[model samples]
Target chain A: MNASEEYEIMIGNHAAAYACKGAKVQVVAAYPITPQSPVVEKISYFIESGELNARMVRVESEQSALVACVAASATGVRTYTATSSHGLMLMYEILCWAAGNRLPIVMNIATRAVGAPWSVWTDHQDAFTVRDTGWLQMFCEDNQEIYDTNLQAFRIAEDPCVYVPTLVSYDGYILSHTFMPVRLEPQSRIDDFIPPLKHHLNLGDMNVVKGVCPVTTPHVVKREEGTAPGYYEFRYSLQRAMEHSIEKVVEVHDLFAEKFGRSYGNGIYKAYKMEDADIVIFAVGSVASESRLVIDKLRAKGIKIGLISLKLFRPFPAKHLREVFKDIKTVVVFDRDVGYGYEGILFTELKSALYQLKNRPFIKGYIVGLGGRDVKADDLINGVLRTIELEKKNEYVEQTEFIGLKLDELDFLKKGGKVENGR
Target chain B: MTEEKDYQKILASVQKPVEGEAGKTGSWSTIKPKINLDKCIVAKMEKNVCHFCWLYCPEPIITRTIPPRILYDYCKGCGICVEVCPHKAIEMVEESEL
Candidate 1:
């Protein structure tokens, strides 16, 4: 271990908080919510003990928390906040404001299931809700990954070339409350890695009077002999930034690896034992971590199977996925959340991504572990084996199938006569 | 080589603070307020006194001086200054009549 590296058993939430401290975040505004509460609590502790020089604004609501971060970020200071589930829903409106303003705010999300029946468990539904908010989205597998990705998130978000907000998410309770050994890099090295925020626009500067994110017209207009772009152009710029941030993400990841001696493959998707495999398992977050076990089990049984753990979700990494899936014959995707009326969210998007490939492999998707349902290794293994069986028989498998669903013996559905979409 | 489209050049929705950003808002109105020097407090008194019109103008085009002059270039002709005039010296006249 490097002399500057300190190893300790840390929870994912604490690890994320340490990353914010190491990055020298100037402002943290957050409301405590289940799973995501500890992250802000730890940050508050660090600020109170004087270990980190920052302001911890105790906000009453998650909406106000994110809004406070937005206001802080506008002044060209590094800002951070954390939330989950209903808290994320509350901050939905301001999420667009932060991205549209290009404020480069970094938010960590402990992925949790949204309510109705009220579940406080691990799921991807909360983070997926804001996938289109022009923010870069990343899901980390383990606690170490949670810490490492949080540091990288700030660098990625604040890059002047890609001045967009970012969401660093991990499975709630699964990673948030779980403890694991993580190596914390020294403050000096982290400082060298992520320098203070620099941007083309600084709302903090009083000398230069400027208006930020004003109500723009539908078309470009002339103001005091100067041309200003309209709302459409502003939104287009945000879209363009997201499209172009893919490169910056890889570059930053590579740079971080070069400096810290650690990196996720291509900074987008990490492929495991896929060099000679024909069938591969695709998943993200904790599900992807579980697929590693499935890969080992399948390989031991003389099956040529591998796994691809997705890290970057937004900007989708379609190009990298296409490159990796080129030689594979079949891909089985496991999702912790469903797209409701449609199939698994990742499954549909992956299909669209590979639609252009002339020799695209047959792909299938499985919905697993919704609302923190226990996804057993046996179930994942069975799903993959079933997929292989279907592939060999050239059987047309359903777009989405369920794993770990115990409704087979349940009599509730049986009592409801003439269900239109009964399984 | 064809020129590539640069989104960065657009710089999103941010812009330097400038006057008349909404275009000459004065054109939006049909009536313009005219101040009568005969009954104007500041104009008749010839001293720096109460220029309520200048303070009450929404667009705030009325300048606080010896006789409070309105900068008509960007004023929306809201007639707010006429309402706030204590001396009843300001009146709104139709732009077409002028």
Candidate 2:
């Protein structure tokens, strides 16, 4: 077999681990959480067997794990870490700090439902909650995309125009634990693709330590000199870096496709069979894989249906989404988590993105799979079909609906009614 | 050894201030610390004390004395001595006024 030939694999976690190793990540900071534990475990074994020369730092908390990586990256080392759900939440405050200070660290997040009833199941809520934390967020559709996108994430995040952290998320328990065929890129090729990191600003150097603040003073003149262009200047520069990442993401994706044989689609949004469809479904994560199968089945029966899988969520890709959904009459958004008082968070953002456009689709937000509940292809098909039906009747539901809810055990409550189970 | 000699030469060049501005004259208009004998705690008591102003100036702007005074031309107005002086003997008077 040729070196370019694909080597199929069975699990997303294994594929992610292989990609990290293939990228020659120098340091691995591992803290175990459900569904994300296997990613670090596989890397640890590889390190012990001398397959990789990575240092695995066993940290006490997710915060310290990220801090350790930040410290290591500041020294101009390639760093990698993985976390899920509560662990991702714990690393929230430092996530902004890392990006603000311009550290290039790559992290893998296994998308799990945040707790109330406590579940280790699949959902995008955990990653979505930190969407505004200044990290480049990418959702993977399958095992191959999971493996290849992780490599691309490093290149994109570390690029000079976009020196921010990145998080590649795969659905917990669904794509993460499930086995699938994934092609591996040669280690040498990946090494050539991602060069060793060169940091522009590193701490502890004599110039940096002495030049940062020569002397501490409480004088107004000295204070103004020290903090000129002040706090807002720092935050504004970070925002500009994130906005600039939109172009860098496409450039790196194209470069990676040229070097390797695989391609992660273009234009920020990937449309499947949406050319002439009157109704389209917008979703992300492993659920998009299921939506694809449903779209294929619906298309065979002569129904005009399609699906738009959101790949990059943080930059939101609003302009690209508007162009894609321009002609469609209705769009049904399947969200894996609820925003409590509002509809699905993605649905709210999508609506706000399309609000000012003269020609826009009527969007319906559906909250599904709250506690790792499985969202089958049939469930998605039914939701899209109902959305089409509502459009045909010229009737729309202003309130969001929870699909696939088991209502046998719970009683319905009115606006002014006391629940029987209440204390 | 060669590098050390080069650095010392650079340091020696900076040590000599421009001529015609020598000793309590010329730009002796530049405020040099003036010790007040009456109000100074150490100068009045004739003791080796009151070095707070000397120790606190960020730029080494305060000249060490029984009660220290400031060299204003080089002082960047950090006001460390003004805040640190226990007897409030030091004031950051304007360089132009001095």
Candidate 3:
């Protein structure tokens, strides 16, 4: 296999599809959703063209899609699925069940905002909602990272240390639809990286049906004992594996970099220009890309500002985040989604992580994009600037603020007057 | 032949309940379905069409005799029988420890 290959322009969804192919996934079950549909489409094309030999189960719903994948995985086949916002929401219960049973199914989730007010745009809310469902969640910054992360997710999920399903997420429209130059790894190398799956239980044996049993009385003594290893022990082991994943993630990234010639940082958080900064801007996904431009502009103006891009949202990365921002005096968190009647979800988690520190920075939460609203570089710059001003005054902003709200439209408030209603 | 023996052993291990053990509802302390006699179509008419609970119970905990009765000891509290009963005869009641 030739190592020096020309860069191919591929969207994040296509990159994920290629990674699935590279992983040698034997079974794929998917239902179409915006931005995520192309992934399954490409894989189906691959299957049709004889490039990949896999069973493509066309399922009715996302729940059935995951159920089919779980059943496939239990039969010792490498299985994968992809879904986004509402589709991911539909698979919530099954996601928990799959992980609880220690199935190593890989799912690529294109991050999109959940609807009710119905907008098909990008946000982290969908992925963040199911953060605790025992799946290893890895967020990518770009198309290449999305490609590499999906490959790594399969290896990590199937590892005996971590036999839980993993979701490799890239922002819906921002990364999924946007085409970028990505290096495709040779199938031979990926084959080496991720081995053929060895299932904990095989359902194909005629004598005994492993893991499946008739529903018995709750008072059944053996059933009580069976619940422990099936539920608690499996969950505990998955948690331990996720906690241990920090090092494994780094190792995989390093090896991938060495083999494929590209690697993102090993830690949960990726810091940029943070070495000697006093104030830092924290964001994820495409907003973080905008934040980097804002940081560069601020740095040019002789302002001490840095950016922390969170790559892994789950396992929360609380300890690493504390260490990264330990020296900084003020931190600004830009959130794309807002938890109703509360601060942004990312801000709340960050605050809880940083609460125990003896001398913590004044972490300001700024709710920004929602429903596909574009966040410009200037908006990020202004948010950081506000944090810097607060640092100068040595006064902490107790309230979470909206970064770009149209205040002039409010009839109750006069021009240039603070609205009586406080958020 | 070996596989056939294993199947036979597994099937043998699954205990078959003895006669008169079917309708004894006293053992169910965790979850039990109650029949509202007035609302029960079968019980009201003294007919057997309302054997829906007995039919729908995945565990087959409810047995149909002259009238269907729940064998509470074996019920796993899935409540499928309660939800599927056409006459609304079966109401799943949470078992309380005295």
- Clashes (backbone N, CA, C under 3 Å), per candidate, total 0, 3, 0
Top candidate by lDDT: 1
Which one wins on TM-score?
A: 1
In model 1, the runs with Cα more than 4 Å from the true position are: A1-5, A210-214, A409-423, B1-5, B15-98
Residue A213 alpha-carbon offset, candidate 2, angstroms: 4.9
Candidate 3 lDDT over residue span A140-241, tens digit each:
889989888888888777766556688888889899989999888777888888888876656666345422324223332253314212233344556776
lDDT value for model 1: 0.86
Q: What CAPRI-style quality would you assign to candidate 1? A: acceptable
TM-score of each: 0.83, 0.76, 0.77
Q: Comparing candidate 1 with candidate 3, which one achieves the higher TM-score?
A: 1
Range of the 10 consecutive residues with the lowest summed lDDT in candidate 3 chain A: A223-232
For each candidate, C-alpha RMSD in Å? 6.1, 11.6, 9.5
lDDT tens digits by residue: candidate 1, A50-129? 99999998878999999999988877789999999999999999999998888889999999999976999988888988
Model 2 sits at an interface RMSD, in angstroms, of: 15.6
Residue A212's C-alpha lDDT in candidate 1? 40
Q: Give the true-structure RMSD of model 2.
A: 11.6
The list of candidate 3 runs beyond 4 A from truth reads A1-5, A206-234, A407-423, B1-98
